[model samples]
Target: MNDKVLIVGAGAIGGFYGGLLAKAGADVSVVCRSDYDVAKHYGYRIDSYALGNWQLMPNQVLRHVSEYQGQPDYLILCTKVTADIDRVTLIRDAVAPCTTIVLIQNGVEIERELQQAFPDNLLVSGLAFICCNRNAPGEISHLAYGKLILGNLSGRQEPKTQYLRDLFLGAGIECVISEDIVASRWQKCVWNAPFNPLSVLSGGLATQAILQNQENFVRRVMREVCSIADACGHPLPADIVENHIALTRDMPPYKTSMLLDFERGHTMETEAILGNAVRAAQRQSVDCPCLESLYVLMQLLELQIRSSSLLN
Candidate 1:
Protein backbone atom coordinates (compact mmCIF):
# COMPACT_ATOMS: atom_id res chain seq x y z
CA MET A 1 0.00 0.00 0.00
CA ASN A 2 1.21 3.52 -0.74
CA ASP A 3 2.04 5.73 2.23
CA LYS A 4 -0.42 8.55 2.75
CA VAL A 5 1.17 12.02 2.87
CA LEU A 6 -0.46 15.37 3.58
CA ILE A 7 1.49 18.50 2.70
CA VAL A 8 0.75 21.69 4.58
CA GLY A 9 1.78 25.04 3.07
CA ALA A 10 2.09 23.81 -0.49
CA GLY A 11 4.36 26.58 -1.67
CA ALA A 12 7.62 26.15 -3.52
CA ILE A 13 9.29 23.70 -1.16
CA GLY A 14 6.18 21.80 -0.28
CA GLY A 15 4.86 21.65 -3.81
CA PHE A 16 8.14 20.43 -5.26
CA TYR A 17 8.84 17.79 -2.63
CA GLY A 18 5.25 16.68 -2.28
CA GLY A 19 5.14 16.31 -6.03
CA LEU A 20 8.23 14.12 -5.84
CA LEU A 21 6.59 11.90 -3.22
CA ALA A 22 3.60 11.59 -5.50
CA LYS A 23 5.96 10.51 -8.23
CA ALA A 24 7.29 7.90 -5.79
CA GLY A 25 3.74 6.51 -5.55
CA ALA A 26 2.69 7.97 -2.21
CA ASP A 27 -0.93 9.00 -1.83
CA VAL A 28 -0.08 12.71 -1.76
CA SER A 29 -2.61 15.33 -0.69
CA VAL A 30 -2.11 19.08 -0.37
CA VAL A 31 -3.73 21.70 1.81
CA CYS A 32 -3.27 24.72 -0.43
CA ARG A 33 -4.14 28.33 0.36
CA SER A 34 -2.93 30.77 -2.25
CA ASP A 35 -2.99 28.27 -5.04
CA TYR A 36 -6.14 26.52 -3.94
CA ASP A 37 -8.15 27.49 -6.99
CA VAL A 38 -5.49 26.57 -9.52
CA ALA A 39 -4.43 23.43 -7.72
CA LYS A 40 -7.98 22.29 -7.28
CA HIS A 41 -8.60 22.85 -10.96
CA TYR A 42 -5.38 21.84 -12.68
CA GLY A 43 -3.07 20.32 -10.05
CA TYR A 44 0.66 21.27 -9.89
CA ARG A 45 2.97 21.76 -12.87
CA ILE A 46 6.64 21.21 -12.02
CA ASP A 47 9.62 22.07 -14.22
CA SER A 48 12.90 20.79 -12.86
CA TYR A 49 16.35 21.55 -14.21
CA ALA A 50 17.67 18.13 -13.28
CA LEU A 51 14.59 15.84 -13.34
CA GLY A 52 12.68 17.31 -16.28
CA ASN A 53 9.10 18.60 -16.60
CA TRP A 54 6.07 16.84 -15.10
CA GLN A 55 2.67 17.37 -13.54
CA LEU A 56 1.57 16.26 -10.06
CA MET A 57 -2.07 15.67 -9.50
CA PRO A 58 -2.49 15.40 -5.75
CA ASN A 59 -4.76 12.68 -4.42
CA GLN A 60 -6.64 15.47 -2.71
CA VAL A 61 -6.54 19.26 -2.95
CA LEU A 62 -7.96 20.83 0.18
CA ARG A 63 -8.47 24.39 1.31
CA HIS A 64 -8.04 23.58 4.97
CA VAL A 65 -6.69 20.81 7.12
CA SER A 66 -10.10 19.85 8.40
CA GLU A 67 -11.14 18.97 4.89
CA TYR A 68 -8.59 16.18 4.52
CA GLN A 69 -10.20 12.78 3.95
CA GLY A 70 -8.32 10.48 6.32
CA GLN A 71 -5.42 10.04 8.69
CA PRO A 72 -2.17 10.61 6.81
CA ASP A 73 0.86 8.50 7.55
CA TYR A 74 3.03 11.60 7.19
CA LEU A 75 2.23 15.28 7.57
CA ILE A 76 4.93 17.52 6.15
CA LEU A 77 5.08 21.16 7.19
CA CYS A 78 6.96 23.29 4.65
CA THR A 79 5.74 26.74 5.67
CA LYS A 80 8.00 29.73 6.32
CA VAL A 81 8.74 30.04 10.04
CA THR A 82 7.69 33.51 11.07
CA ALA A 83 6.16 35.21 14.10
CA ASP A 84 2.86 35.73 12.33
CA ILE A 85 2.26 32.04 11.66
CA ASP A 86 1.30 29.60 14.39
CA ARG A 87 2.29 26.37 12.65
CA VAL A 88 0.84 24.01 15.22
CA THR A 89 -2.52 25.74 15.21
CA LEU A 90 -2.66 25.67 11.42
CA ILE A 91 -2.45 21.89 11.22
CA ARG A 92 -3.70 20.74 14.60
CA ASP A 93 -7.08 19.61 13.39
CA ALA A 94 -5.74 17.15 10.85
CA VAL A 95 -2.77 15.76 12.78
CA ALA A 96 -3.77 12.26 13.74
CA PRO A 97 -2.13 10.71 16.79
CA CYS A 98 -0.39 8.13 14.60
CA THR A 99 0.90 10.65 12.08
CA THR A 100 4.61 11.31 11.79
CA ILE A 101 5.18 15.05 11.71
CA VAL A 102 7.95 16.21 9.39
CA LEU A 103 9.12 19.80 9.38
CA ILE A 104 11.12 20.78 6.33
CA GLN A 105 11.74 24.36 7.35
CA ASN A 106 14.70 26.70 7.84
CA GLY A 107 16.29 27.78 11.13
CA VAL A 108 18.14 26.22 14.06
CA GLU A 109 16.34 25.11 17.25
CA ILE A 110 12.89 25.06 15.64
CA GLU A 111 11.94 21.50 16.53
CA ARG A 112 11.20 21.89 20.24
CA GLU A 113 7.82 23.56 19.87
CA LEU A 114 6.40 20.83 17.65
CA GLN A 115 7.97 18.19 19.84
CA GLN A 116 6.20 19.75 22.79
CA ALA A 117 2.93 20.03 20.92
CA PHE A 118 2.87 16.44 19.72
CA PRO A 119 4.76 14.64 22.41
CA ASP A 120 3.46 11.21 21.49
CA ASN A 121 3.90 11.47 17.73
CA LEU A 122 7.18 10.89 15.97
CA LEU A 123 8.78 14.15 14.84
CA VAL A 124 11.26 14.34 12.00
CA SER A 125 13.29 17.42 11.17
CA GLY A 126 14.22 17.87 7.54
CA LEU A 127 16.07 20.34 5.37
CA ALA A 128 15.91 20.94 1.61
CA PHE A 129 18.93 22.23 -0.24
CA ILE A 130 17.27 23.40 -3.37
CA CYS A 131 16.68 26.51 -5.42
CA CYS A 132 12.94 26.28 -6.11
CA ASN A 133 10.16 28.80 -6.43
CA ARG A 134 6.54 29.11 -7.48
CA ASN A 135 6.44 31.25 -10.59
CA ALA A 136 2.67 31.40 -10.60
CA PRO A 137 -0.24 29.59 -9.00
CA GLY A 138 0.37 25.84 -9.35
CA GLU A 139 3.59 26.37 -11.32
CA ILE A 140 6.91 25.48 -9.69
CA SER A 141 10.35 26.10 -11.15
CA HIS A 142 13.11 23.89 -9.76
CA LEU A 143 16.03 26.02 -10.80
CA ALA A 144 18.94 24.18 -9.23
CA TYR A 145 20.10 21.60 -6.68
CA GLY A 146 17.57 19.50 -4.76
CA LYS A 147 18.76 17.27 -1.97
CA LEU A 148 16.97 16.43 1.31
CA ILE A 149 18.45 15.54 4.69
CA LEU A 150 16.09 14.07 7.24
CA GLY A 151 16.44 12.63 10.74
CA ASN A 152 14.47 11.93 13.86
CA LEU A 153 14.89 14.70 16.43
CA SER A 154 15.24 12.14 19.22
CA GLY A 155 18.49 11.01 17.53
CA ARG A 156 17.15 7.54 16.82
CA GLN A 157 17.49 5.96 13.39
CA GLU A 158 13.76 5.61 12.85
CA PRO A 159 12.47 3.23 10.19
CA LYS A 160 10.03 5.87 8.90
CA THR A 161 12.89 8.24 8.15
CA GLN A 162 14.60 5.52 6.15
CA TYR A 163 11.37 4.76 4.36
CA LEU A 164 10.99 8.41 3.37
CA ARG A 165 14.58 8.38 2.12
CA ASP A 166 13.89 5.28 0.05
CA LEU A 167 10.80 6.97 -1.37
CA PHE A 168 12.83 9.96 -2.49
CA LEU A 169 15.57 7.76 -3.86
CA GLY A 170 13.01 5.78 -5.81
CA ALA A 171 11.96 9.05 -7.46
CA GLY A 172 15.62 9.77 -8.34
CA ILE A 173 16.01 12.44 -5.65
CA GLU A 174 18.99 12.44 -3.30
CA CYS A 175 17.92 11.95 0.31
CA VAL A 176 20.29 11.47 3.24
CA ILE A 177 19.31 10.36 6.72
CA SER A 178 21.25 12.07 9.51
CA GLU A 179 21.74 11.05 13.13
CA ASP A 180 22.23 14.70 14.09
CA ILE A 181 19.80 16.85 12.14
CA VAL A 182 20.20 19.87 14.44
CA ALA A 183 23.85 20.23 13.51
CA SER A 184 22.81 20.00 9.87
CA ARG A 185 20.41 22.89 10.45
CA TRP A 186 23.26 24.99 11.82
CA GLN A 187 25.45 23.99 8.89
CA LYS A 188 22.80 25.17 6.44
CA CYS A 189 22.41 28.35 8.47
CA VAL A 190 26.09 29.00 7.86
CA TRP A 191 25.05 29.93 4.32
CA ASN A 192 21.56 31.29 5.09
CA ALA A 193 22.68 33.62 7.94
CA PRO A 194 24.60 35.77 5.48
CA PHE A 195 23.04 35.46 2.02
CA ASN A 196 19.35 35.59 2.97
CA PRO A 197 19.31 38.85 4.91
CA LEU A 198 22.09 40.37 2.83
CA SER A 199 19.97 39.80 -0.23
CA VAL A 200 17.22 41.87 1.38
CA LEU A 201 19.51 44.51 2.91
CA SER A 202 21.26 45.02 -0.42
CA GLY A 203 17.93 46.23 -1.82
CA GLY A 204 17.27 43.04 -3.75
CA LEU A 205 20.51 41.40 -4.89
CA ALA A 206 21.06 37.78 -5.90
CA THR A 207 23.35 35.46 -3.98
CA GLN A 208 26.19 35.77 -6.50
CA ALA A 209 26.04 39.59 -6.56
CA ILE A 210 26.15 39.84 -2.75
CA LEU A 211 28.95 37.30 -2.52
CA GLN A 212 30.89 39.04 -5.27
CA ASN A 213 30.62 42.47 -3.66
CA GLN A 214 31.12 41.36 -0.04
CA GLU A 215 32.68 37.95 0.23
CA ASN A 216 34.58 38.90 3.37
CA PHE A 217 31.42 39.97 5.14
CA VAL A 218 29.65 36.77 4.14
CA ARG A 219 32.48 34.62 5.51
CA ARG A 220 32.50 36.56 8.79
CA VAL A 221 28.79 35.91 9.37
CA MET A 222 29.18 32.22 8.52
CA ARG A 223 32.06 31.90 10.98
CA GLU A 224 29.94 33.49 13.68
CA VAL A 225 27.19 30.92 13.06
CA CYS A 226 29.79 28.15 13.28
CA SER A 227 31.00 29.53 16.60
CA ILE A 228 27.48 29.49 18.03
CA ALA A 229 26.89 25.97 16.80
CA ASP A 230 30.08 24.80 18.43
CA ALA A 231 29.22 26.48 21.71
CA CYS A 232 25.78 24.86 21.56
CA GLY A 233 27.58 21.49 21.36
CA HIS A 234 26.80 20.79 17.70
CA PRO A 235 30.16 21.37 16.07
CA LEU A 236 29.91 21.52 12.30
CA PRO A 237 32.44 20.27 9.76
CA ALA A 238 35.87 21.94 9.83
CA ASP A 239 35.66 23.08 6.22
CA ILE A 240 31.93 23.93 6.19
CA VAL A 241 32.59 27.62 5.61
CA GLU A 242 34.79 27.17 2.56
CA ASN A 243 32.46 24.50 1.19
CA HIS A 244 29.48 26.87 1.48
CA ILE A 245 31.33 29.75 -0.12
CA ALA A 246 32.46 27.58 -3.01
CA LEU A 247 28.95 26.22 -3.47
CA THR A 248 27.47 29.72 -3.55
CA ARG A 249 30.08 30.92 -6.03
CA ASP A 250 29.07 28.14 -8.38
CA MET A 251 25.30 28.47 -7.83
CA PRO A 252 23.17 30.22 -10.39
CA PRO A 253 22.45 33.88 -9.63
CA TYR A 254 19.34 33.52 -7.50
CA LYS A 255 17.26 35.54 -5.10
CA THR A 256 16.86 33.81 -1.75
CA SER A 257 13.52 32.78 -0.25
CA MET A 258 13.73 35.64 2.24
CA LEU A 259 14.24 38.15 -0.57
CA LEU A 260 11.38 36.59 -2.50
CA ASP A 261 9.09 36.93 0.54
CA PHE A 262 10.12 40.57 0.82
CA GLU A 263 9.35 41.15 -2.85
CA ARG A 264 5.90 39.61 -2.40
CA GLY A 265 5.24 41.47 0.87
CA HIS A 266 4.89 38.11 2.60
CA THR A 267 6.12 37.45 6.12
CA MET A 268 9.84 36.60 6.09
CA GLU A 269 11.59 34.07 8.35
CA THR A 270 13.73 36.77 9.98
CA GLU A 271 13.43 35.31 13.47
CA ALA A 272 13.72 31.72 12.37
CA ILE A 273 16.88 32.09 10.27
CA LEU A 274 18.83 34.77 12.18
CA GLY A 275 17.14 35.60 15.47
CA ASN A 276 17.12 32.04 16.78
CA ALA A 277 20.82 31.64 15.98
CA VAL A 278 21.65 34.90 17.77
CA ARG A 279 19.68 33.85 20.83
CA ALA A 280 21.46 30.49 20.86
CA ALA A 281 24.76 32.37 20.70
CA GLN A 282 23.80 34.53 23.66
CA ARG A 283 22.66 31.53 25.69
CA GLN A 284 25.96 29.78 25.05
CA SER A 285 28.03 32.95 25.72
CA VAL A 286 29.38 32.83 22.22
CA ASP A 287 30.61 36.06 20.65
CA CYS A 288 28.71 36.58 17.42
CA PRO A 289 28.82 40.27 16.65
CA CYS A 290 28.21 39.79 12.93
CA LEU A 291 25.26 37.44 13.45
CA GLU A 292 23.79 39.78 16.06
CA SER A 293 24.03 42.70 13.66
CA LEU A 294 22.22 40.76 10.93
CA TYR A 295 19.46 39.82 13.40
CA VAL A 296 18.86 43.45 14.37
CA LEU A 297 18.81 44.64 10.76
CA MET A 298 16.32 41.97 9.79
CA GLN A 299 14.13 42.92 12.74
CA LEU A 300 14.08 46.50 11.55
CA LEU A 301 13.23 45.42 8.02
CA GLU A 302 10.41 43.26 9.35
CA LEU A 303 9.09 46.19 11.36
CA GLN A 304 9.21 48.38 8.28
CA ILE A 305 7.29 45.79 6.33
CA ARG A 306 4.65 45.57 9.04
CA SER A 307 4.33 49.36 9.12
CA SER A 308 3.95 49.58 5.37
CA SER A 309 1.29 46.91 5.41
CA LEU A 310 -0.71 48.81 8.03
CA LEU A 311 -0.62 52.08 6.09
CA ASN A 312 -1.39 50.59 2.73
Candidate 2:
Protein backbone atom coordinates (compact mmCIF):
# COMPACT_ATOMS: atom_id res chain seq x y z
CA MET A 1 0.00 0.00 0.00
CA ASN A 2 1.15 3.51 -0.70
CA ASP A 3 2.21 5.13 2.52
CA LYS A 4 2.03 8.82 1.71
CA VAL A 5 -1.21 10.09 3.20
CA LEU A 6 -1.97 13.72 4.07
CA ILE A 7 -4.58 13.92 6.81
CA VAL A 8 -6.14 17.35 7.24
CA GLY A 9 -7.69 18.30 10.58
CA ALA A 10 -6.30 16.01 13.27
CA GLY A 11 -9.54 15.56 15.13
CA ALA A 12 -11.44 12.39 15.96
CA ILE A 13 -11.79 10.76 12.55
CA GLY A 14 -8.54 12.14 11.26
CA GLY A 15 -6.57 11.09 14.31
CA PHE A 16 -8.13 7.65 14.40
CA TYR A 17 -7.49 6.83 10.73
CA GLY A 18 -4.20 8.66 10.60
CA GLY A 19 -3.00 6.93 13.74
CA LEU A 20 -4.10 3.59 12.36
CA LEU A 21 -2.34 4.23 9.06
CA ALA A 22 0.76 5.29 10.91
CA LYS A 23 0.69 2.29 13.24
CA ALA A 24 0.34 0.10 10.18
CA GLY A 25 3.59 1.64 8.92
CA ALA A 26 2.06 4.13 6.46
CA ASP A 27 3.88 7.43 6.23
CA VAL A 28 1.18 9.67 7.65
CA SER A 29 1.42 13.42 8.09
CA VAL A 30 -1.28 15.15 10.10
CA VAL A 31 -1.97 18.77 9.18
CA CYS A 32 -3.10 20.58 12.29
CA ARG A 33 -3.16 24.11 13.64
CA SER A 34 -0.97 25.60 16.37
CA ASP A 35 -1.40 22.42 18.36
CA TYR A 36 1.02 20.72 16.00
CA ASP A 37 3.92 22.18 17.95
CA VAL A 38 2.68 20.80 21.24
CA ALA A 39 1.82 17.49 19.62
CA LYS A 40 5.26 17.31 18.12
CA HIS A 41 6.80 18.15 21.45
CA TYR A 42 4.89 15.31 23.06
CA GLY A 43 3.42 13.02 20.36
CA TYR A 44 0.20 12.39 18.44
CA ARG A 45 -1.35 10.52 21.36
CA ILE A 46 -4.58 8.74 20.50
CA ASP A 47 -6.43 7.13 23.41
CA SER A 48 -9.30 5.34 21.73
CA TYR A 49 -12.06 3.47 23.54
CA ALA A 50 -13.83 1.53 20.79
CA LEU A 51 -10.93 0.23 18.74
CA GLY A 52 -9.14 -0.95 21.92
CA ASN A 53 -6.05 0.95 20.87
CA TRP A 54 -3.73 3.79 21.78
CA GLN A 55 -0.91 5.42 19.85
CA LEU A 56 1.78 7.96 20.64
CA MET A 57 4.17 9.13 17.98
CA PRO A 58 5.75 12.04 16.13
CA ASN A 59 6.14 11.63 12.41
CA GLN A 60 5.20 14.70 10.39
CA VAL A 61 3.10 17.22 12.30
CA LEU A 62 3.32 20.55 10.51
CA ARG A 63 1.80 23.83 11.74
CA HIS A 64 1.66 25.92 8.57
CA VAL A 65 0.64 24.93 5.06
CA SER A 66 3.95 26.23 3.74
CA GLU A 67 5.81 23.77 5.99
CA TYR A 68 3.99 20.87 4.38
CA GLN A 69 6.49 18.93 2.30
CA GLY A 70 6.17 16.10 -0.23
CA GLN A 71 3.23 15.78 -2.63
CA PRO A 72 0.49 13.61 -1.20
CA ASP A 73 -1.03 10.69 -3.07
CA TYR A 74 -4.12 10.94 -0.89
CA LEU A 75 -5.55 14.10 0.68
CA ILE A 76 -8.07 13.03 3.29
CA LEU A 77 -10.25 15.81 4.73
CA CYS A 78 -11.76 14.90 8.13
CA THR A 79 -13.11 18.25 9.25
CA LYS A 80 -16.71 19.19 9.96
CA VAL A 81 -18.70 20.07 6.85
CA THR A 82 -19.23 23.73 7.72
CA ALA A 83 -15.52 24.47 7.95
CA ASP A 84 -14.49 27.21 5.53
CA ILE A 85 -13.49 26.35 1.99
CA ASP A 86 -10.32 28.34 2.28
CA ARG A 87 -8.88 25.54 4.43
CA VAL A 88 -9.03 23.21 1.44
CA THR A 89 -7.66 25.88 -0.88
CA LEU A 90 -4.78 26.45 1.49
CA ILE A 91 -3.68 22.83 1.20
CA ARG A 92 -4.20 22.60 -2.55
CA ASP A 93 -0.60 23.53 -3.18
CA ALA A 94 0.63 20.51 -1.19
CA VAL A 95 -1.27 17.99 -3.32
CA ALA A 96 0.15 16.52 -6.47
CA PRO A 97 -1.85 16.59 -9.69
CA CYS A 98 -2.95 12.97 -9.25
CA THR A 99 -3.76 13.22 -5.55
CA THR A 100 -7.13 11.74 -4.59
CA ILE A 101 -9.12 14.07 -2.32
CA VAL A 102 -11.26 12.05 0.07
CA LEU A 103 -13.79 14.05 2.12
CA ILE A 104 -14.62 12.23 5.34
CA GLN A 105 -17.21 14.73 6.51
CA ASN A 106 -20.73 14.24 7.90
CA GLY A 107 -22.98 16.14 5.51
CA VAL A 108 -23.85 15.90 1.80
CA GLU A 109 -22.77 19.27 0.38
CA ILE A 110 -19.05 19.15 1.12
CA GLU A 111 -18.33 17.13 -1.99
CA ARG A 112 -20.40 19.64 -3.97
CA GLU A 113 -18.38 22.57 -2.63
CA LEU A 114 -15.07 20.77 -3.17
CA GLN A 115 -16.08 19.86 -6.71
CA GLN A 116 -16.88 23.49 -7.37
CA ALA A 117 -13.55 24.60 -5.93
CA PHE A 118 -11.32 21.92 -7.44
CA PRO A 119 -13.05 20.94 -10.62
CA ASP A 120 -10.02 19.21 -12.09
CA ASN A 121 -9.03 17.10 -9.12
CA LEU A 122 -10.57 13.81 -8.08
CA LEU A 123 -13.15 14.12 -5.30
CA VAL A 124 -14.53 11.21 -3.29
CA SER A 125 -17.27 11.13 -0.63
CA GLY A 126 -17.06 9.20 2.62
CA LEU A 127 -19.57 8.48 5.38
CA ALA A 128 -18.44 7.11 8.74
CA PHE A 129 -20.83 5.45 11.21
CA ILE A 130 -18.65 5.76 14.25
CA CYS A 131 -18.59 7.53 17.61
CA CYS A 132 -15.43 9.54 18.32
CA ASN A 133 -14.35 12.69 20.07
CA ARG A 134 -11.20 14.78 20.53
CA ASN A 135 -11.32 15.53 24.23
CA ALA A 136 -7.78 16.85 24.37
CA PRO A 137 -5.23 18.21 21.97
CA GLY A 138 -3.35 15.39 20.20
CA GLU A 139 -5.77 12.92 21.66
CA ILE A 140 -8.83 11.18 20.18
CA SER A 141 -11.32 8.90 21.88
CA HIS A 142 -13.46 6.46 19.98
CA LEU A 143 -16.76 5.60 21.59
CA ALA A 144 -18.46 3.15 19.24
CA TYR A 145 -18.52 1.73 15.71
CA GLY A 146 -15.78 2.43 13.13
CA LYS A 147 -17.29 1.34 9.85
CA LEU A 148 -16.86 3.59 6.80
CA ILE A 149 -18.82 4.00 3.55
CA LEU A 150 -17.27 5.60 0.49
CA GLY A 151 -18.39 6.42 -3.06
CA ASN A 152 -17.54 8.41 -6.13
CA LEU A 153 -20.39 10.91 -6.21
CA SER A 154 -19.36 12.17 -9.65
CA GLY A 155 -20.08 8.66 -11.04
CA ARG A 156 -16.61 8.15 -12.41
CA GLN A 157 -15.20 5.04 -10.72
CA GLU A 158 -11.63 5.16 -11.84
CA PRO A 159 -8.76 2.77 -11.12
CA LYS A 160 -7.39 5.13 -8.46
CA THR A 161 -10.68 5.01 -6.64
CA GLN A 162 -10.60 1.24 -6.71
CA TYR A 163 -7.07 1.28 -5.39
CA LEU A 164 -8.10 3.53 -2.52
CA ARG A 165 -11.04 1.28 -1.74
CA ASP A 166 -8.77 -1.74 -1.72
CA LEU A 167 -6.35 0.06 0.56
CA PHE A 168 -9.04 0.74 3.12
CA LEU A 169 -10.26 -2.82 2.93
CA GLY A 170 -6.75 -4.06 3.56
CA ALA A 171 -6.62 -1.79 6.56
CA GLY A 172 -9.57 -3.71 8.01
CA ILE A 173 -11.94 -0.78 7.56
CA GLU A 174 -15.39 -1.81 6.32
CA CYS A 175 -16.27 0.18 3.17
CA VAL A 176 -18.58 0.01 0.17
CA ILE A 177 -17.88 1.39 -3.29
CA SER A 178 -21.49 2.31 -3.76
CA GLU A 179 -22.93 2.57 -7.27
CA ASP A 180 -25.96 4.54 -6.10
CA ILE A 181 -23.90 7.08 -4.21
CA VAL A 182 -26.58 9.80 -4.13
CA ALA A 183 -29.08 7.33 -2.77
CA SER A 184 -26.54 6.16 -0.24
CA ARG A 185 -25.85 9.74 0.82
CA TRP A 186 -29.51 10.55 1.30
CA GLN A 187 -30.24 7.26 2.98
CA LYS A 188 -27.39 7.91 5.35
CA CYS A 189 -28.95 11.31 5.97
CA VAL A 190 -32.15 9.58 6.99
CA TRP A 191 -30.31 8.47 10.11
CA ASN A 192 -28.23 11.62 10.58
CA ALA A 193 -30.89 14.23 9.75
CA PRO A 194 -32.82 13.39 12.89
CA PHE A 195 -30.23 11.90 15.20
CA ASN A 196 -27.58 14.65 15.07
CA PRO A 197 -29.69 17.64 16.06
CA LEU A 198 -32.05 15.54 18.15
CA SER A 199 -29.09 14.31 20.16
CA VAL A 200 -27.97 17.88 20.66
CA LEU A 201 -31.41 19.30 21.42
CA SER A 202 -32.69 16.48 23.60
CA GLY A 203 -29.37 15.36 25.12
CA GLY A 204 -29.99 11.72 24.40
CA LEU A 205 -28.66 8.86 22.36
CA ALA A 206 -30.51 8.24 19.11
CA THR A 207 -32.11 5.00 20.20
CA GLN A 208 -32.94 6.33 23.65
CA ALA A 209 -34.58 9.42 22.23
CA ILE A 210 -36.45 7.37 19.69
CA LEU A 211 -37.70 4.95 22.34
CA GLN A 212 -38.13 7.32 25.27
CA ASN A 213 -39.51 10.68 24.30
CA GLN A 214 -40.89 10.68 20.73
CA GLU A 215 -40.82 7.40 18.90
CA ASN A 216 -43.43 8.66 16.46
CA PHE A 217 -41.46 11.84 15.90
CA VAL A 218 -38.37 9.82 15.07
CA ARG A 219 -40.41 7.73 12.65
CA ARG A 220 -41.98 10.89 11.24
CA VAL A 221 -38.61 12.47 10.51
CA MET A 222 -37.37 9.30 8.87
CA ARG A 223 -40.58 8.96 6.90
CA GLU A 224 -40.36 12.53 5.68
CA VAL A 225 -36.68 12.22 4.78
CA CYS A 226 -37.43 8.93 3.04
CA SER A 227 -40.18 10.69 1.11
CA ILE A 228 -37.73 13.36 0.04
CA ALA A 229 -35.32 10.60 -0.91
CA ASP A 230 -38.04 8.90 -2.93
CA ALA A 231 -39.03 12.19 -4.53
CA CYS A 232 -35.37 12.59 -5.40
CA GLY A 233 -35.72 9.05 -6.88
CA HIS A 234 -33.80 7.24 -4.11
CA PRO A 235 -36.45 5.39 -2.17
CA LEU A 236 -35.14 4.06 1.12
CA PRO A 237 -37.49 1.21 1.92
CA ALA A 238 -38.94 0.37 5.32
CA ASP A 239 -36.57 -2.55 5.69
CA ILE A 240 -33.61 -0.18 5.48
CA VAL A 241 -35.04 1.95 8.23
CA GLU A 242 -35.67 -1.17 10.28
CA ASN A 243 -32.09 -2.26 9.80
CA HIS A 244 -30.75 1.22 10.64
CA ILE A 245 -32.90 1.42 13.73
CA ALA A 246 -31.44 -1.88 14.81
CA LEU A 247 -27.94 -0.58 14.23
CA THR A 248 -28.60 2.55 16.27
CA ARG A 249 -29.93 0.36 19.04
CA ASP A 250 -26.61 -1.46 19.16
CA MET A 251 -24.56 1.74 19.48
CA PRO A 252 -23.19 2.72 22.87
CA PRO A 253 -24.31 5.67 24.93
CA TYR A 254 -22.79 8.51 22.98
CA LYS A 255 -24.04 11.97 22.07
CA THR A 256 -23.81 13.29 18.55
CA SER A 257 -20.89 15.44 17.41
CA MET A 258 -23.15 18.48 17.22
CA LEU A 259 -23.90 18.05 20.91
CA LEU A 260 -20.18 17.94 21.62
CA ASP A 261 -19.75 21.19 19.71
CA PHE A 262 -22.69 22.71 21.53
CA GLU A 263 -21.22 21.68 24.88
CA ARG A 264 -17.92 23.27 23.91
CA GLY A 265 -19.69 26.50 22.94
CA HIS A 266 -18.54 26.13 19.34
CA THR A 267 -20.67 26.64 16.26
CA MET A 268 -22.48 23.48 15.27
CA GLU A 269 -22.40 22.04 11.74
CA THR A 270 -25.75 23.64 10.96
CA GLU A 271 -25.55 24.29 7.21
CA ALA A 272 -24.30 20.90 6.17
CA ILE A 273 -25.88 18.39 8.54
CA LEU A 274 -29.39 19.63 9.38
CA GLY A 275 -29.73 22.53 6.96
CA ASN A 276 -29.13 20.45 3.83
CA ALA A 277 -32.05 18.14 4.49
CA VAL A 278 -34.31 21.09 5.31
CA ARG A 279 -33.30 22.90 2.11
CA ALA A 280 -33.73 19.75 0.08
CA ALA A 281 -37.17 19.26 1.55
CA GLN A 282 -38.10 22.80 0.55
CA ARG A 283 -36.72 22.37 -2.96
CA GLN A 284 -38.60 19.13 -3.46
CA SER A 285 -41.80 20.47 -1.90
CA VAL A 286 -41.64 17.92 0.87
CA ASP A 287 -42.85 19.25 4.19
CA CYS A 288 -40.56 18.11 7.02
CA PRO A 289 -41.93 19.45 10.27
CA CYS A 290 -39.63 17.48 12.55
CA LEU A 291 -36.55 18.59 10.68
CA GLU A 292 -37.78 22.17 10.54
CA SER A 293 -38.63 22.21 14.23
CA LEU A 294 -35.25 20.76 15.23
CA TYR A 295 -33.45 23.23 13.00
CA VAL A 296 -35.21 26.17 14.62
CA LEU A 297 -34.68 24.75 18.08
CA MET A 298 -30.99 24.27 17.44
CA GLN A 299 -30.66 27.80 16.13
CA LEU A 300 -32.29 29.16 19.27
CA LEU A 301 -30.16 26.95 21.50
CA GLU A 302 -26.99 28.09 19.81
CA LEU A 303 -28.01 31.73 20.01
CA GLN A 304 -28.71 31.35 23.72
CA ILE A 305 -25.42 29.54 24.32
CA ARG A 306 -23.38 32.12 22.44
CA SER A 307 -25.20 35.02 24.07
CA SER A 308 -24.68 33.51 27.49
CA SER A 309 -21.00 32.74 26.81
CA LEU A 310 -20.37 36.30 25.73
CA LEU A 311 -22.03 37.61 28.87
CA ASN A 312 -19.92 35.33 31.03
With candidate 1 superimposed using the best TM-score fit, by how many Å does residue 208's alpha carbon deviate from the native? 2.3
Provide the RMSD of all predictions against the true structure, rounded to 1 decimal: 1.2, 2.6
Candidate 1: what lDDT? 0.92
Lowest-sum lDDT 10-residue window in model 1:
300-309
Decoy 2 TM-score against native: 0.88
Which residue pairs show backbone clashes in model 2?
A: none
* lDDT string, candidate 1, 188-230, tens digits: 9999999999999889999999989999999999999999999
Residue runs of model 1 more than 4 Å from their true location after superposition:
none
Residue 102 shift from truth in candidate 1, angstroms = 0.7
lDDT by residue (165-222, candidate 2, tens digit) is 7776665666678766777877888787777788877754545655466656777787
